[model samples]
Target: MRLSAEQISHIRAVIHECDPEARIYLFGSRVDDHKKGGDIDLLIFSKHLTERDKRRIRLRLYDRLGPQRIDIIIARDLSRPFVRLAYAEGVEL
Candidate 1:
């Protein structure tokens, strides 16, 4: 994965602060070490997190990680095709 240990730690901390039971995954180009210059792709599974909570999480991440592209998918339905793909391909963090 492209993320540093500190980055991962910060991400986990921020997410857990909002939803302690949330599951986090890193997917897309960031998951491939050979890839370059891709945004951080996160697939988060949390039943309690709303759209506002998702926005707050993203903003907090930006505050700590700087102004960069971070694509986040707050997954509630595991049945969605995209969510299924993400979960299958993603690396759990």
Candidate 2:
């Protein structure tokens, strides 16, 4: 995985602050060792996440993780096929 221990820790902490039961996954290019310079892709699973919740979690994560391209997929927002694949293949953080 592309993330360091500290990065994962921060992400987990931020997500848990938003929802303690949230399930976080690290996927896409960041999960594969062979890839390089990919944005952070995260699949967050929680019960009944609203737009407000998404925004809050996003802002908090960016604030803690710094300014970078981060792609987040809430479980209920799993519309695309690739996102499902990502959830299946993604490493849980």
Tens digit of per-residue lDDT, candidate 1, span 25-86? 99999999998999999999999998999899999999999988988999887889999999
Best by TM-score: 1
In terms of lDDT, the poorest run of 10 residues in model 2 is: 75-84
Q: Estimate, for each residue in 1-93, the C-alpha lDDT of model 2 and write its tens digit.
A: 989999999999988887888889998899988888889888998876767888888888899889978888887646779778988899999
Which portions of model 1 miss their true places by more than 4 Å? none
Can you list the residue pairs that collide in candidate 2? Answer: none
lDDT winner? 1
Question: What are the C-alpha RMSDs, in order, of all predicted structures?
Answer: 0.7, 1.9
Each model's number of backbone clashes?
0, 0
